[model samples]
Target chain A: MTETAVTRPTEIEWHGVSPKYIAVDLIGTAVSALIFTAAATVPYWLIQEPWALIPSAAVLLVHLVVLVLTPRRIRSIRYALRADDLLVRRGIMFTRLVAVPYGRMQLVDVNRGPIARAFGLSELKFVTAAASSNILLPGLPAEEADDLRDRLVALAESRRTGL
Target chain B: MTEPLPPRSDTQRPEEREGLGSPLTEGRGADLAGPLPAGNPRTEGAGFEAQQPQPLQSLATAPLTTSLADGEWHRLHPATPLLRGGIALIAIVGFLITNLRDRFIEGFLPMYRDEDYSGDPVEFLVGEGLLFWALLATLGVVLVVVFFFWLSWRFHTFRITAEIVEVRQGVLMRTNRRARLDRIQGVHIQRPFFARLFGAAKLEIEQAGDDANVQLSYLRGHEADALRRDVLALASGAQRAAAAAAPAAPNGVPGLVEARVQELLAPELDPAEAAAESVVRITPGRLIGSVLLSSGTLSVLAVLAGLGIVSLVTGEPIAVFGALPALLGLGTYLVNRITSGLRYSVAGTRDGLRVGYGLLSTTNDTLPPGRVHSVQLSQGLLWRPFGWWAIRVNRASRSSTNAQQQQTRSLVLPVGTLDDAVRVLELMLPGFDAATVQRAAAAKGGEPDDPFTNSPRRARVLRWFSRRRNGFALLPDVVALRRGWLWRELVLVPLPRVQSVAIRRGPLLRALRLAGVHVHTVAGPISSAIGALDDADAQRFFDEVATGAVRAAGNDSSHRWRSAEAAS
Candidate 1:
């Protein structure tokens, strides 16, 4: 009697992704900030423009903010797989909960970048027919990622069966 | 996670599931795996090609219908590859040639002044009569494209059976797609200007799911027409069986309507039906008015005025030239709209709705019943005075090559009177008739009427810009939302199409005792929802939408509930 794709957040239990995601974000922010700081020095040295210091100083401030916020940001990212749908809740400030029903999922992509691979983590991307309904679950343990991908594919197939 | 349905294959491994369950390759795998006896229960000790065991394979129970026993391949009309997807291939090759030329010249530029090179590569090539080699390269590129087109055409094939209609073609990642006849919503045979010259037409067999539809292009126009008829006939036959299987309705009229729905769903593409009821037309005056009334045009004018003011203040007359691109862009947009909306017309076909419009590249789209996810009857700022509604729907399309095409194609009626919008809406949502839609549209925007529940004044400050025009009307099956004063948009979200609904209360809204109702639908251009309604009203709205969705969801449980073992 209680069967169907009823997307209730309360019923769907979400699990936090691998904590190494904090390290991943920190590394990413550090690298990008380092590059920006280096590039900002060129204009500063060439023109001795007081404005150039603003960029380098801004980069340091950004790095500090990223370092402080990375753990909390990582903590806020969670994903859940219900019987009939995949749920992803992300973003620290502007929370977004995208629930992609299993029947609606067209593609399941498990992408592993260099940094992710180094951390033994992967991002699972769920592509639905709707262009904007794609959900990305970043920083899941590699084994869990593959497991989720296979489970989703199987679930989608079974749900689509007899339809 | 608990699976609702118990495991059918106990011993199936993860890799096996991956191999057998991938939606794109599942059909090919079933046929290619040499017919496993367990999967193909009917083919037990029987010849593989025999399709007729029992006629009603709803594509519900058995999705991957094996290839015919004969293994006969039905290729597309020879020119299909060249006509349909050839331009994209040719464009890529042209882009590569131009990119190569520029790259070669740029690479030599660094070395031209060094000891390794004496002169400019461009001059040397042209001066040395190397243009012939470039021409040869171009010819080689064209040949490669021709070879690909040939391969594409060679691989492209389609087969029609009683159960499903399938089109299989892909050069590298081969796709074997099957469209279940029962799920067939609409079929269109389209011929573009050039394709018409070639006497070729494309058959679009739109089905239920985004992935399941079949588009077979470049068939002989006559053959395409015949094939379209055959598909519709087969689909109708299946639907007829379903209608019989469906229980008798409480009222005799509902039963008749059910049969009529099926009839409308499978209208014959005959010449007579082509001249069916002409429901609405976009007159020249309306077209021009809508174009001028477009918020986009006013914004362009505003930007232009701002640029003029800046130029005057700076006393640099040439500074006004910064507005050139904006002017040119606005002009181009106006031309495109005029061209496209020149002959916009919506006609009622036997099965559903047929909307045809466009001047340069005309598209004749047919939407069978239950295809539209939602509809929006919007009136731009200027159109408010004239009382023109631009009716757009989130039509049944999986993907579009470009966002612009999505907007253009979703327009069933670009601009019309209030009655026209109602007519089109009722056509899409038959249960909600013209009177219902008319009343819904003309309802008062403030206070709680029978149909409408307006936002409270506390929420108005939260609505901010769209303070005046914010309200919602609740019908049995649809929830109509009115928002935006400057660019007034009337959004109608069909209950069944409402994928997700949530009552959002941000810090500001919560403090103001106001909450926002957010309705999520399949992603499209229109984001339909009203924000900053009274908090208590928002909760009530959420419960009502949920009830509507659950009640309607039963109708399309994908026949799961009906076919469950415990059911009759």
Candidate 2:
């Protein structure tokens, strides 16, 4: 896929998420996956249906695969603050790169989950007038997240174009 | 005369004055006369400065603005209560009271409780010779309902000023909605079946936000039309001097009987405002054919046939009943579509595009220039034979519920010939040349000279049949996404309205070294996505569209289309 990487200009500097996000995301994914699997097998606990565990096992397998690729996925999440818009790219098997204009930004939020907080990391989200452009850049140092929010909010205010 | 005008210090240069003044006064000077040039922060402040004194000057000089535009609150039509579901509520209550008189009386008056035996409440009331009492009680209930309706109507007042249209509604929980004239996306007038009988219409002032539309339900039909024109005029930043002189007001709201008679006698099309003839007319035969050939109809037919086959083979008629509800739903949709298609009209008016349709309940949606975010022209498999296409647009105004109804409203042209489709397309994307529209509309791909950068041949593994057809073209003003070999869809998104640009590649696409590109616009029926292009092409498209959108957004003064036209 990188064979034609020349198409992307070399000048733009892309920023990647924190490496520690891999551990936090993997733990979160594993906990949720375990809860779901346990919930799905509740029927087995009640009626002792062996087939219910089959579906539960399948869910566990999917979670295991996700846990294996968590680090790569985290490393792939990158964002760049361009002159007039912010560009965010993530995913390996299913790659997505989105460019959202600063003028259209409706709100910028910085939040940290308990696990991410323990890791001293926060997530920065950008909401635009268009609902589909859901840009959430997760796993930044707390200070960087605050600084980025202030800078982006300032930029948005300056460029406040109507929808 | 008492208020001194701001000094015209910058009036020495006629061009500067023309550029700064309202478009109606500087009609021929549009290019440089747009109220605010994009990217010029100071011009926006200057625009407010320039507009503040114009109305005061108009008041002094003309003072002939319509009574409705006098910057005062106006009550809705007198029968607004009846038109706003009051009759239905009363009827439901009356029916319930008649059916459950015993329970109704017992619930309210325990002294009249009848717990012995309940055969029929109405029968019991009659046997007890309480029918008159019941009737009297019903009359009292009706009076109470009417009182509430009056209260609601009294509280729902709307005011229009030079800068904004404000609607204050609610009996207790007051909700005030103000739509800035500058941000008005469109003005729509809808006359429901019952409302039409009363010769009233609902005027909706659509702005760009969630649930922010200000609706003045049940205005006199003629009043709605006149208000739409006036609101559009003001929103366009046009001087109201000409409109003030226009003789649109009727003497007064006529009585119900006379109004109904007038409605019946009046021509369907308002000759003065809506053009006598639409730019494209969908014939009855064509409309019927399009409905019959629509994918929805075909799918319904398929399900019916499938059910019939299953019943015939399995000897189980119950299977058919399983799909009865689903079939009934689809039938209602088809019926609704056919009726709405009747008497459909799409015409270009001086203000912008005027689209009207309906047999009993009618709607005329006026979209000012540049309000359309994106447009999708699609040809169903059955439609291809007749060269029939439907055009739907993405607009900023989205109703929170009944998304399907909202989508149907977004449909500018339900069904039209290729030529008709082209005409509608040209109207929607004003600045595009006919050649570009035709190229985008008729391009079937595989042509070396086609303007679009098509998917690479290797991408055939993913697209299969649509390998050659799936492509995108980035025009100076719009980006076109062409897809589907059989269904055949072309989505054109104005660069300025593009909220964002995304390039994606799923596992399978990555396996084949292919990518997809999407030009994001406001959420609506139109999908502005193109998939399975050469990875390189996708990357280039992402970069180009990103930069193009930024540049276009920076220069976009389309919000004030009339003034932009004056400047250009």
Cα error, residue B358 of model 1, in Å, equals: 5.5
Cα lDDT tens digits, model 2, B454-547, are 8888988878888788898888788888899888998899888888889887878877778888887887787888888887888889989998
Give the per-residue lDDT of model 1 (tens digit) for B255-281.
544543432333333444454655787
Model 2 score (lDDT): 0.75
Residue ranges of candidate 2 with Cα displaced over 4 Å: A1-9, A33-57, B1-64, B86-136, B242-247, B250-259, B265-269, B319-331, B565-568
Stretch of 10 with least lDDT, candidate 2 chain B: B1-10
The TM-score that candidate 2 achieves is 0.84
Best model per lDDT: 2
Question: In candidate 2, how many Å is residue B299 off?
Answer: 0.8
Once model 1 is optimally superposed onto the true structure by TM-score, how far is the C-alpha of residue B165 displaced, in angstroms? 5.1
